[model samples]
Target: MELDKMDENEWRYHGEGNKSLVVSHVQLSIVLRLLKYPAEDSENPPQTVEQAFRQVQNIVDFSSNVMSCLLGEKFVHSGEVVKLPLEFVRQLSIKVQHQRPAWRCDKVMDIYSGCALCLPNLTSPTLHQPTHTPTLCIEIKPKCGFLPYSKHVSQDIKTKVCRFCMHQHYKVAMGTWKRRSRYCPLDLFSGNRQRMHFAIRQLIDEPQNNLKIFKGGRCIFSSMDGIEDSMDLNSLLHHLRPYFQYGNNRINSHMTSKALLTDFIQVVVNALLSAGGGDGGVGTDRRGEGRSFCEASLFNKERSRHGSQGSPSDSVLYRVRQTQMLDTLDIEGLYPLYRRVEQHLQDFPKERTRLQMDGPYNEAFLEKLHKCPSEDDGSLEYAVSKVHQYRVAMTAKDSQIMVALVPSCEEEEDDEGLPGQRQHRDFLSSRPPAFSYSVSILDLDPKPFDNIPRQLRLDQNIVSCYLRSSCALP
Candidate 1:
């Protein structure tokens, strides 16, 4: 049985084509470079296999370096040497011998390069033997039962076909069976399917600690699909679990208050949608969001003074804290939601639309007045109201939401004595209020900010007032 028999003729042709040859050359060159060979020889002619291999290696090394610079520090692991299979070498030797009469050295090099690139993913542990053996080996005779005889259909051909083993006879003559079903020593005693299944089970049961193991490894006996799916899902859940817990935690951690968590989630969702243009670089999407989420949580430890009289003006910082929390908690949902929202916006009407308020306390509202449709039902109004409600709820529980928003000495204390418990001496030492302002939201026309800055300012002022008033209430 031949390898070509198993794969489609087109794929086999592609594997033997010029592109495959170039990739092979690049791969071979990379391997040679890894072995510390002097790849360039200005004085030497390029006829020899050794010289050609060296030249290819040099090109691959140069390409790898360029790619590394453009991408990052470790875009390509150039040092790793890939071993060629003895069977591949043998096949190349046969082709070289057959084509030697007509093909020039350069043509042969091209073929060699293509063969290298076309080599399937290597199985591990790679045969590390010093002798360069072909990855596959086969022996053939004209009289062999599996060999194609005549173009005409005849009774003698049937007898000859049956003489060879059932697998090889049917596959070689008809070209319709497991092509790799060779009469090799390995295949003779062992069933390939059983061996493959065992290998896959072992890999599944005992996966590699490092994910890089999958690179250039054999697919046979490896539950790569299953493992990859599980890993990705696990990663998604692991990053998102904390945000949900933080949002729901009754005794909130200083760095991840409920209000801040909600804000962080909103920012993350917005960032995923590429909405509200901002330098969201580190907090932009899944990968960036993860990094920013962790960093923000760490930074909030210092900013969330954790106790004492809250500072209301530190709302901006509080909002930042919320953005951080949201980025971490809803990262999983953010990507999916962003995709859904983008699709929704594309399909949603551009004409006049209505707003609907629903959900917890009927506080959530949809604001379709914006140029684009909202991705999620929660609009700016609902978001602001949610933040205000969260703040009020925390305050009512005797927790200082303002203190958690700002960095201050007084806010650092874990416990502030009850109203009647504080000594008169302590009261005397307290400083006077620095400044104050009320916050609320006001309705304004949905027009671009370019024409009416004053209107926008008023609208903003109204929104702040509304939020502050909502926070102030029972």
Candidate 2:
């Protein structure tokens, strides 16, 4: 395909992360994900053309071959690696510069590297929706779902408190976040519909880094860089009401803001709960309250019991919770193993990059992990094996769940009847809503082998700070 003729201007900034910038093609159902790196850093310089190609190729292959096996294959897409002209990359970078969040400008797009990842625009409204049918895409960064049950976990607090909750204190102390978000991963991971709804409500209340609302593949609401000014509820509701009201004229005319917002949140909740394939039988009429972040502790035995028992074995959240259990040794035990692996790798550097494109764990290794070892088999081989499993689990923990909702076009509206009024009633009979939805897992990048030590230190800091603060007291 002649990518140059597509007009660099057609590519608009979609969203970004610490490592890459994603831009969507206006007229096409695709997006180009570009890598990002330091501007003048000597240690981490721009990759050469060959290196850049291999890097993106590695990502594609790893996501396709490895992550797909861990997460469901239907939810994971390993897009093709496309090499753009350097000039085209440069212009596209410049064009989207103004659209990026201010704080995210630190690491600019790799203008020197021509390689880009071409992915299907999962949230594309033009391709996925009928005319005047607005599409709502909810991006949820559901952090680690389960607390450490490993005996090797030195800190009793780590066993009692989830990593995401403890990290909130650290974030607040660092001034990186304006305040602590009440959204707990445990609550979201809890299979109970009420708890899940409550968790999503908390996210909507304070989106900070974890939740984002997109309309037509463009970010309409998010707490960009954890800024205080981005928490405008009125703006979020305004953007959401249009999509909810577009077809059902009767509901649109009479729907209050409260009802509209509830319906919107229900759509997202329905998508998440239905991950196992049912119509997510959760109701949206009555709002469910939940324990505060401070009160929502894993130490609460009743809460923990419900989480373990209430969750569906086949659901996506259940799968993630199970994947998270790979860290059976926790970071405490994983650290020693990590050091051993590092030393061994240094001793035999030749084995460091074997099957590198397949990510840290191979299919055989992953299958063994899925079997769940019965004992704390402490050996160099065991450590090596579990470390890879731990890394894969970490990737799953940091991944985002993209829930896309578009009005279903299966039934044709009667020619003599109102546009969508008659169809809206038919759509809401027994299911959550008339909308057709899709759920996909995103951000499947492999964590570096060396990040284990950094995690250990961060875990220490988070636990220490939380204990020192007043929030730690039960």
Candidate 3:
């Protein structure tokens, strides 16, 4: 299965085979080259080749354990769906530092733990006592997993309050309030502060809305992770066996895992952006837009085969650098209160997230892709041309992290001199138990959808019978 972010120029695929020997050799070679004896324009290698090799080996072993934990519940299962929780865009580095990894592995650091990465140092016992920075690869697991069911919404007092708190909470904590009365956690009983607390008080007064908070939902099931819940369709029909099913019956076997995973990942990426107003505008109803899977991708067919090519040599196709994309935007440079990101998500009614994927996985697209020559071949040109039509490439230069008010049972004491004073207990804090945020993919788990039951629901007799009536095919 191929996954591509044309905008970021990144791609990934799935593989299920054991190649430890080959992988280890490749890792060793990389280490040797990095720490090789000879010096170029750069400084001398920190360690000898043999030392580097051992470190690399240690890294590989550590990575395996980390991967296993990230996979979590899916580790032992086959055809496992994988999603890297950390969203930082730096390349994996082999730390030439003298100290070993604090945990099971060698001295290599958890990429998130580095002070250079711009993560906040939460001073709590939960943090490592020495550094007070998080040691584990902290990732946010999506509470609801996918988008909750909401299509149209008005900007209620609750939403505005949530946004105001989310956008301003950090500033208040840092003693950098812009609009002083907007939301002062200290003046909890004051007039304007009381008005700002209206939404919070409303939830506290009403029991129903309070219930949804624990369930990881709010007044509206906002479109998140790219599912324009505006899908008015009763149910999604997952077709198993298309008429042109290719060799080895690729549909029955491979279809269940890779294909679903491809769409799932794309949906999530979009949802995350939309939740944070990365869509740049309001969400659109994709189905209402009269869009259909070109080759019946998820619908179980091939992409329309048109012999065409897009700009194969076009260097700047989706040219937004990682540093620029808000998804991976550096946090250290960001200011908590003055952070200028897309605000007022409730302004849009329908989900504004755009669809990135063209169609689900199909052999024809793959075969045509594989047949393409190194340069501009007819097959490649055709695939690229069609891919262009999936979704209009959109970029936002000023996107910021999405944070909203969350309901929590905890509260921070007003005492500033206390040990936990820096750690705010209010609902506005981004740190968890009481905040809803769509900042980065770090907050999401890459768990695969259960397709076994969906596949079993498919029967050849039912498919053929339905096809005969619908398409009049003999």
Per TM-score, the best of the predicted structures is 2
How far in Å is the alpha carbon of 61 misplaced in model 2? Answer: 1.7
Q: Indicate whether candidate 1 or candidate 2 has the larger lDDT.
A: 2
**What digit string (tens of lDDT, one per residue) describes model 3 on residues 1-474?**
111221111211100011101001111111011111222312444454444344433333222322212222111111112122223212323322211112212222222321111112111112111222111111111111111111211222211122223323333444443332222111111111222133222222221211111111111111111223211111111221121123354435444433442332222222222323121223222211111111111111222122112111111111111211211111111111111211211353131122112222233323332343333233424333222211111111211111222222234333232353112222222211222222222111111112212322332222333334335524
Ranked by TM-score, the better of candidates 1 and 2 is 2
Question: Which ten contiguous residues of candidate 3 have the minimum total lDDT?
Answer: 14-23
Off by over 4 Å in 3: 1-115, 120-435, 441-474
* Order of quality (TM-score): 2, 3, 1
Per-residue lDDT of 70 in model 3: 24
| Ordering by lDDT | 2, 1, 3
Assess every candidate by TM-score.
0.17, 0.85, 0.18
Report clashes for each candidate as comma-separated counts. 35, 0, 15
Positional deviation of residue 82's Cα in model 3 after best superposition, in angstroms:
31
Ten residues in a row with the worst lDDT in model 1? 398-407
